[model samples]
Target: MKLISWNVNGLRACVNKGFNEYFAEEDADIFCLQETKLQEGQISLDHGEKYRQYWNYAVKKGYSGTAVFTKKEPLSVSIGIEGVEETEGRVITLEYEGFYLVNAYSPNARRDLSRLAYRLEWEDRFRAHLKRLDKQKPVVICGDLNVAHQEIDLKNPKSNNGNSGFTLEERGKMTELLASGFIDSFRHLHPDTKDVYSWWSYMPKVRERNVGWRIDYFLVSERLAPAIADARIECAVMGSDHCPVVLELNGF
Candidate 1:
């Protein structure tokens, strides 16, 4: 099966940038979207009419949100991790026969780190949630995790040290997650791969220089690692500041 995740930034705006065409071209069996930045009744997609669409919109307009488009129907679905109280609409989970697919958009710590406390709290709850799901079945977690895990994940680790996504605290949370029986699919495939990134700044020269971060991911439960045939970053595809991350599994 093929699963793809992307932080569209804003579904409405991306649609104008040929998002529909891009969506169809990828032809993912399941497409998970983060940072939708829209509420109910705001956007609709018809790229694949056979796919079932599920959305979790925040109470606030034009803000954080997530959605999932899947070719297979899930046994059940959920909104967010328990006790997190995510009014920003940060997560969505679909329970299939053999696995749970979670789409998430981890909160940014802000340039000043004002939201760091909340982000930490989120990490704990989020990890717990995934662990619980993993106990039931293998899990496929995807979307923008909002952190550049290691030096290889971004272009300039030395210069970007202590930045919101690269801060020690944030990187530690990621380590905690992977230690808790999850695997970072892309890193597993290309451990020494460099310069491959999923998110870039809006600055004119940043994207061109390929100065970006690998904040987005397609992480799966450790037990399912053998099924991960390939993982890729679609750096050439562009609409938002972020690009889509793809994971191909051995069996759908």
Candidate 2:
């Protein structure tokens, strides 16, 4: 099975930039999106009839949201995690016969770190949610997690240290998640690959110079690591500040 995850930044704006063309060419079995920034009836997407669309929209207008277009029908679909009232529509869980696929857009800590506390709390709850799903079956979690996780995850690590996404607190939470029986697919496959990134800053020539962070990911239960066929960062495909990250598995 093939799964692709991307943070479109804004779905409507991305469509104008050729999102549909890339989507068709990829032909992914499951395509997950983050930061859609729209509500129901705001825009229309004709992803063909084979894919089943699921969306989670935020209460705020043109704010954080997520969507999933899957070729396979999920046995059940749910939004948000248990015990957490997610007003921003950040998470969507689709239960398939073999696994639970979770698409999440983690809350950013903001440039001034104003939301650091809330972001940490959200991480704790999100980790707990994933653990709960893992207890039932292997889980495949993907999207823009909003953290660099380690010094190696971002370019110019010394300069980015303590920044919102690279802070010790945020990075520790990611470490804790991986320790809790999950494997970051990309890192698992290419432990020492460098200069590769998924999200880039909009600063002049930043992306051209490849100054970016590997913030988006496809993480799966540790047991599923053996089934991972390929994991990659599609940096060339552009519509947003972030690009798509892909994961292919041997068995459904």
Candidate 3:
């Protein structure tokens, strides 16, 4: 099975930039999106009429949200963490016979770090949620995690060290999550891969220079690692500041 995750930045804006064209070309069995930035009824997406589309929209209009488009219908769908009081529409859980797919748009620690505390708190809750799901079945977690977990994940680690996405605290939280039994599929496939990133700054020539951060990911439970046939970043595709990250699993 092939799955693709992308932080479209804004789904409506991305659609105008040929989102459907690229989506068709990829032909993912399950396609997930983050940062959709729109509420229900604002935009209609026609993914060839074959996909079973599921969306989670925030109460606030034109803000954080997520969506999933899968060719195979899920056995069940969940909006957010079961016990957590959330309203940003940051997550969608789709349960299949084989695994649970958790599509998440992690809260971004703002540029000023004002949201850092909330971001960290959310991380703990999110990790706990995944662990609970893993107890039932393997979980495929994908989206813009909003943090660059390692020094090699960004263009200039030295200069970006203390930034919101590259902060020590944020990185540590990612480490904790991985240690808790999830594997970062991309890194597992390409251990030493460097300079390849999923997200780029919108500044002039930044994308051309490939100055970017690997914030988006396709992570699976540790036991599912052997099934990861391919994990890659589609850097050449362009629509949003972020590109698509893909994971192909065998015999799933």
Candidate 4:
């Protein structure tokens, strides 16, 4: 099975920048999106009739949101994380016959780190939520997780250290998640690959120079590692500050 995850930044704006063309060209089995930044009835997407769409819109209009478009219909679909009142519409879980697919847009700590405390708390709950799903079946979690994870994950880590996404707290949570039973698919497959990134700053020459972070990911249960056929960063694709990440699995 092939899956793609991208942080569109804003779906409407991205569409104008040729999102549809890229979507059709990739033709992934499942395409997950983050930071949709729209509510219902805001915009309609013509992705053909073959794909089924699922959206989670935030209570706040034009804010944080997520969506999934899949060629295969899931057995069940759910919104939000367990035991949490999710007002931001950051998570969507689709239950398939073989595994659970979770699309999440994790909260950013903000430029001033004002939301760091809340972000940390959210990480704890999110981890718990994933663990619960893993107990039932292997899980495929993907999206813009909003963390750089390690030094190799971002360009100029020394300069970015303690920044919102690269802080020790944020990276530690990611480490904890992987330790619990998940595998970061891209890093697992290309452990030494450098100068590859998914999200970039809008600053002049940032993206051009490849000064960015691998904040987006496709993490699978450790047992599913053997099924991983490919995991890649689609850095060339454009529409938003972030590009798409692709994952391919075999015998799913």
Candidate 5:
């Protein structure tokens, strides 16, 4: 099975920027998107008839949202974690016969980190939510996680110290998640790979210099590590500042 995750920045803007063409070329069994930044009735996709689409729009239009386009029908679909009232559309869980596929748009701390406390709370709830799902079946999780997990994840770790996405607190949560039997598919495959990033800053020359962060990812239950065929970052794609990340599995 093949899965792809990307943060499109804005679904409407991306549609005109070869989103349809790139999406068609990838031909993933399941595709998840984050940072859609739209609301209900904002945008639509016509990707032939084979793919079934599921969207969770935010209460605030042109804010945060997520979507899942899968060729295989899910047995069930959930919008957010239990006890969490997610008006921002941060979580989407699709239950398939083989595994549960979850796409998450993790909350960002912002430049001043004014929302850092809220972000931390969200992380706790999210971790608990994933653990609950694990009790039922293995999970294939992906999307724009919004954190640079280590020094290797970003270009200039020293300069980014304590920055919103590169803070110790944020990265620690990721460590805890992996410590609890979750595998970062790309990093697991290339433990020491450097300068391989998924999201680039939209400033003048960040992308050109390859100064970016691998904030997007595909993670799975530890038991499925052997099934992981390949993990890649499609850096050449250009629509959003972020690019697509892919994970290939041997069995469905």
Candidate 6:
């Protein structure tokens, strides 16, 4: 099975940039999106009748949100983490016969670090949620995690060491998550690959120069690691500041 995850930055704006065309071409078993930045009834996507659409929209208009398009219907679908009052529509989960697929748009710690504490708290809750799912079945977690996990994940790590996404605290939280029985699919596949990234700054020349961060990911339960056929970044595709990350799994 093939799955693709991308943080479109804004789904409406991305659609104008050929999202539909790309979506049709990929024809993945499941396609997930983050940071949709739209409320209900803002836009419509025609993915053909083969796909089932599931959306979790934020209460605030034109803000954070997520969606999933899958060829196969799941056994059950869930919105947000249990016990958490998530108003930003940051997460959605689909329970298939074989696994639990989680689509998450993690909260970004603002540049000033004012939201860092809240972001950390959210991470803890998110990790706990994943752990609970893992106990039931293997989990496929994907989206813009909003952190560049390690020094190898972003360009100029030295200069951006203390920045919001690259900070020690954020990186540590990612480490803790991975240690809790999850594998970062791309990094697990290409251990030493560098300069490849999923997200780039919109500043002038940033994307052109390939100065970016691999904040988006597809993480699976440790036991599913053997089924990982391929994990890659589609850096050449363009529409949003972020590109798509693809994962191929064998034996379902």
For 1-252, candidate 6 gives per-residue lDDT tens digits of 999999999999999998999999999999999999998888988766999999999999889999999999999999999767979999999999999999999998999999999999999999999999999999999999999998899989999999999999999999999999999999999999999999998899999999999999999999999999999999999999999999999997
lDDT of each model, Cα atoms only?
Answer: 0.94, 0.95, 0.94, 0.95, 0.93, 0.95
**lDDT of residue 247 for candidate 3:** 96
User: What is candidate 2's CA lDDT for residue 212?
Assistant: 95
TM-score per candidate, in order? 0.98, 0.99, 0.98, 0.98, 0.98, 0.99
Tell me which residue pairs clash in candidate 1.
none
lDDT of 3 by residue, 117-232 (tens): 99999999999999999999999999999999998899999999889999999999999999999999999989999999999998999999999999999999999999999999
lDDT of 2 by residue, 129-186 (tens): 9999999999999999999987788998999889999999999999999999999999
Would you list the rank order by lDDT, best first?
2, 6, 4, 3, 1, 5
lDDT of 5 by residue, 160-187 (tens): 9999999999999999999887999998
Show model 3 residue runs off by greater than 4 Å: none
**lDDT digits (tens) for residues 42-127 of candidate 1:** 87777556799999998898998999999988999999889988698999999999899999999999999999999999999999
Give me candidate 1's TM-score against the actual structure: 0.98
Q: Which 10-residue window in model 1 sums to the lowest lDDT?
A: 41-50
Candidate 4 weakest lDDT stretch, 10 residues = 80-89
Error of 4 at 131 (Å): 0.6
The per-residue C-alpha lDDT of model 4 at residue 47 equals: 74
Q: Clash number for model 5? A: 0
Off by over 4 Å in 2: none
The RMSD of every model to the true structure, in order and in angstroms, is 0.8, 0.6, 0.9, 0.8, 0.8, 0.7
Candidate 4: misplaced stretches above 4 Å? none
